[model samples]
Target chain A: MPHDHHDHDHPHSLLPSDPALRVKALETLLVRKGLVDPAALDAIIDTYETRIGPQNGARVVARAWADASFRARLLGDATAVISEMGYYGRQGEHIVAVENTDSTHNIVVCTLCSCYPWPLLGIPPAWYKSDAYRARVVREPRQVLAEFGLVLPEGQTVRVWDSTAEIRYLVLPQRPAGTDDLTEEALAALVTRDSMIGTGLARAPE
Target chain B: MKEPVFLEPWHAQVFALTVHLSDTGVVSWPDWAATLGAVLAEHGLDRQLDGGEDYFLAWVAALERLLAARGLAGAADLDDLKSAWTEAYLHTPHGQPVRLAGG
Candidate 1:
């Protein structure tokens, strides 16, 4: 007990170290000040939490897997084709769809910052914004993918796409084998969020 | 291991606040992205951000800067209100909702 400041609680030390409290306080302040509409804030949060998410990307992927012509259009102009399906907005402008072929595997990383296609993918996962993933994925994609339990074949090439604010990417994963009989809705179920992110493959038929 | 998109409630709240601000034409998305980008670059140089508390803290900081620039709120105002909320919560008993005066 040499020099413990908390031994005697000072008045100034009453401030909680929790940032969550601070954020709530800030929100209250903003609302009181008439700066932001509380309803609007709730609406935005609800949209991200409920309406928008990787499910949209999964549908896009499933469609591409089920329809060859749609796949070609998606590959040609992802932004235009994706918007046609009513999935378009901020953070997803100028999207480029990169298909995962037998010889080449494409992965996305925002080395500088987390520049993701929010409309299609919704909020990016925590790992996507981590410094380690951002720094290492481009340099050693095979190693990174291995950590994600995705081991590519010896002949397959690993292509890392570093996303930017102006341009974003969506990886179209290869469809699992023996899923030809699967319906588009069922195909959508097999498409996991990571499949579109290129860190993991689509779920196998079960 | 699969992780949640937002680690904390405040993370989503702050993010939503920024989006709401953008939607209302209070600030443009480009400006918000640029501010957050600058903040990330500034704070990310030393610490290894895991997109958890530290990441959202930076987001709050960037939001503060944007709000200050737009004259919506200033640093002093945020600090004062934070202190007031701290006082309110400290006096509040356990399992009770903390409220500001007349709030």
Candidate 2:
């Protein structure tokens, strides 16, 4: 079943060693036991691959960039605003939007566990879950951001939000200069997953 | 509360695997709960004390035990894969994706 669908161009050798084999072996063994359904696994993968993830969050950011009223609403009530856009689910039931201003920069981390806005982010990055990040981000937000290649102005203050099971956070990164003419769709293309987490900045206009 | 946020792709894969196994009657929720509880007890994992950092680690350990007990996978297979990943990670240059050589 693992090798049945080989339509994608991804080189099989490029996948991570341990996880890939483990998954494959587990799937094969389970299927043999008649205990697991391949279709269910496929559905889960399809959901993350095609239906959910950073693109949804990008659209929200793009809309905020294009509409002042919507931005205000997003900042004031992220859960309700995101729900209005049909992006509320599971880990994203309660959402909070933190805006990055000229004088202030915001970043998010979950010290307790990897609590995140799943409906928006799909899945968190590996570094986000590493013990190093979980322990250090809250204590040294600026240093962590710098490690991600984001060096803010000396005058700007860094604010770090600790996401929990009760509430999740999304960083609204400041729009870069020279993007006044870009359409909302173009603006969305600039929003990366790291920017929403506050570890990296949005892509600069090229 | 809500399910834990999956950081690595592997985390989600493991989760989906478990859920599918349960849904298909390969493993029941009660069986998983008992296995996970035993694992936590063995590790002396106190949620309040650990701050929930090792939740997924515990889950993986329990899953491995379940598979082994059910004759689905052996310890050797899991260890071999773990070693391969460790080797790949060690050889991989910073910022490059880790992949096993000759894989």
Candidate 3:
């Protein structure tokens, strides 16, 4: 039989190889006051993954690009306006849509946890919750964005919004160059899911 | 022993879907899970049991523990988050679930 030794990538599963051995291990860890029960942390992850996702936010971005009046309305009444789509079910009472201009770009991160605009974008992508991405992006926005294939010129402030509260933000990137003939629906298709999350830009058809 | 890992289609789909979302730009969800999964592995821990879907359950268990300890959010927030999740990814034939008062 293969050895049941635990290691990185597949560690000691919650259940031990042997019931008796498992009890002994628990005695050393839980019984002997060793490791903490990671219940709260788990709940936090489920809360975001289950409640909010990036797709919700993407819908809003698509709508804004399609209508001028809606764009104006989005900036002025983001929460109220999005509610009309019936995406207003949960913690979406407060939605702040950040526009991306030629000089400015916006991305979001939750330093403590992966707090996201669940109502807008749905659950955030897995990488958003990583320590490396969250800790680094806010401080070294350009470097992190570059990792995501987003290269900005020197001196551009990569505005990183920490969506740690009710006010979740969705980045509305500037329309890409070329392909002006694309219809609104086509443009909506051009809006890459990443653009709404601010990691990438929306590209117009060539 | 844990229940089967990847038992249901939706369960497995959720995991893969999460990865796709991360690839797109919703970075945190997968990153955090990977980080946590790495830590558990390093510490000689199994993120889930042998049974299919245990891994997903483990993820849920870990996230719950994290949030409850923080105390910043509560059942309502979790519910809202869940509702948002269902709408964004679950794709139920019926309309979205009724939003709870707090949600």
Candidate 3 chain B, poorest ten consecutive residues by summed lDDT: B43-52
Runs in model 3 with CA error above 4 Å?
A1-56, B1-103
TM-score of each predicted structure versus truth: 0.87, 0.63, 0.54
Q: For candidate 2, lDDT tens digit of each residue in A63-122? A: 999999999999999999999999975567789999999999989987655677878988
Instruction: Estimate, for each residue in A1-206, the C-alpha lDDT of model 3 and write its tens digit.
Output: 46544433442232222222222222222212323233432443454456445545655676787778999999887888888976764336577888887677888776644556556766445466555676688888888989999898776667888774456777887877774566766677667667887888887576
Q: Which residue pairs does candidate 1 place in steric collision?
A: none
- Candidate number of the best TM-score: 1
Model 2 Cα lDDT, one tens digit per residue, B58-101: 56777888989987778887666566666665566655766556
At residue A69, candidate 2 shows an lDDT of 99
Candidate 3 lDDT: 0.55
> Which residues of candidate 1, in runs, are more than 4 Å off?
A1-17, B1-3, B93-96
What is residue A28's positional error in candidate 2, in angstroms?
Answer: 11
Clashing residue pairs in candidate 2 are none
Among all windows of 10 consecutive residues in model 1 chain A, the one with the lowest summed lDDT is: A7-16
Which candidate should be chosen as best, given lDDT against the real structure? 1
As for candidate 3, its interface RMSD to one decimal place is: 17.7
- Scored by DockQ, the top model is 1
For model 2 chain B, give the 10-residue run with minimal summed lDDT: B44-53
